[model samples]
Target: MKKNYFFSIVALLTVSLGSMQGQVVNGTFENIKDNGLISNWGMNFFTPITIDAETGETTQDFITFGCWPGFVFPSWDANHGQHAMQMTNGLNVTTNTIIPAKSILFNDPKQDIPGWNPGIPVDLSDQVAMLGFDYKFTRMGNDIAEAELVVFGTDGQELGRATVDISQTNTQYQYLYEPVQFTSFGIPASIQVSFSMAKEGSVPAFGSTLIVDDVIVSYAALANDEFQSTQFIVYPTVASSEINIVKGSTAPSGNYNFTITNMEGKTVSNQSIQLSDNNPFTVDVSQLSKGIYFISSKGFSTKFMKQ
Candidate 1:
């Protein structure tokens, strides 16, 4: 009995480690040198600039009207106010990635941009979490303004918002360790997250500069519950026509048959396939109806939906 218990514990640990091995990053902005990477990734530019990779220097042609023309700005900015925005070597060494906001011009509260948008059609639909990065605000002059972290969900609705006040006397660099939760927006797939600054009143909109570094995002597990020794998962609560199955084990030579059933114990779909060594499999649910269904294979059973 003791040996059986020990092996069970070991199996559980192995499965947990395997599940955590493939958390994907929705997007990474590490190669934003010049406008090449940004433009290629569908990012619109409001400023003409050159990014020096060797020295991490970003220079913008301030004379161009498009440089700072709009009332809203998406990327980082710098102006001639005793300090110009430049990438910091210290943050780069610590985070192992180029950090934005090191060389920042005063953050104009009037310049707020749209954040994340989970493009779906439901409430409490999409959930997103971002980790890493630290923000520091320095009050050079006697100016007071407020900063905010905004999250937008599917259907272009504001899901979450957090505000921080900036003043001249604050010494400690506050880490924005806040999490945004969206429970009702029914988006089951990918979403976007953005960070920006805001102002309270019309106090001439002082240039309060804010710094950001080491950005990371976290996501929910593909499966809702633990898979037995032989199990897999398909997720995004209200899944679209397409679904993904993440495998659990890496054992060689395993043949499994997938079966789907409705809530009323009626078989909906079934397929047989042989897994290669230990690779994951993706199944298409486009033919399924818009209701709760169960997927069973090997010795495991899980629930999913098609919308």
Candidate 2:
């Protein structure tokens, strides 16, 4: 028989590629103990550890889902209170690779483990670039779903990459910003994110869903750079301190660069103004630390209130 059927197909592909090679889970999917499991997220399977013959110990389990059902929904599909995370594309009978849904927010999602390795080590060297999230996708036929953020540089290279893909079919949640250019040499230690709905080539008849929520990684610079500062107004909309900036004439005529954010956008206060046309600009947030604030120059930004 053809050499014993080629050694039984090489021992059945070496026991299915050595049992899929374990580790790497949980990334905000909140390792919930079921009820819509989300622990370390997975789909392509591979989470089975278990040693312990004499005294050596090892224990880790869970990883059999073929696809679809990333689980964790709670707050009615979430966006606010409870939780949020869902991915569906189903199908994983034998492998056309209809899985691979991913989720790893570091702190140890497990891996070769021995000297440290498993995303989550984020440094981003200073200013921080961009990597935002909060999505909701649902495409049936056209099937499309992809949300990624890759950053690494503690020598592992790769440094930056942000992606967002959705086959247009939203019903609500949307705000998937991504912008991390990279190339200042090195800095960003590690970070690997994922939010996929299974997409590569064929297959697209299943449910085709994707619903993620809140995964902000901060440092957004580029609110519309290049100067356009036009439009400015801020006066007693309620301030227990001091705030005044009245520039009109389409503003932006010369010196610029002004920021004062605080509604969570955190910037506190910045300045560097000199828009000719006489004078009408002043900001001191008094002593800041009150409440809502936003001045963002150039492309103009509003919102004020510190009381």
In model 2, which runs have C-alpha deviations exceeding 4 angstroms?
Answer: 1-90, 93-126, 139-170, 176-186, 189-191, 197-206, 211-217, 225-307
Residue lDDT tens for model 1, 213-263: 323233232223222343455554347776656565653455668888874
Measured over all alpha carbons after superposition, the RMSD of each candidate to the real structure, in angstroms, is 22.0, 17.0
Q: Residue pairs in steric clash, candidate 2?
A: 25-40, 26-40, 229-298
Q: What does candidate 1 score in Cα RMSD to the true structure?
A: 22.0
Cα lDDT of candidate 1 equals: 0.37
lDDT of 1 at 273: 57
Q: Write the per-residue lDDT of candidate 2 for residues 90-165, one digit (tens) a residue.
A: 4444343444343333342232111223345553333445565556776777767666767778888886777766
- What is the lDDT for 172 in model 1? 30
- Angstrom error of the Cα, residue 101, model 2: value is 4.1
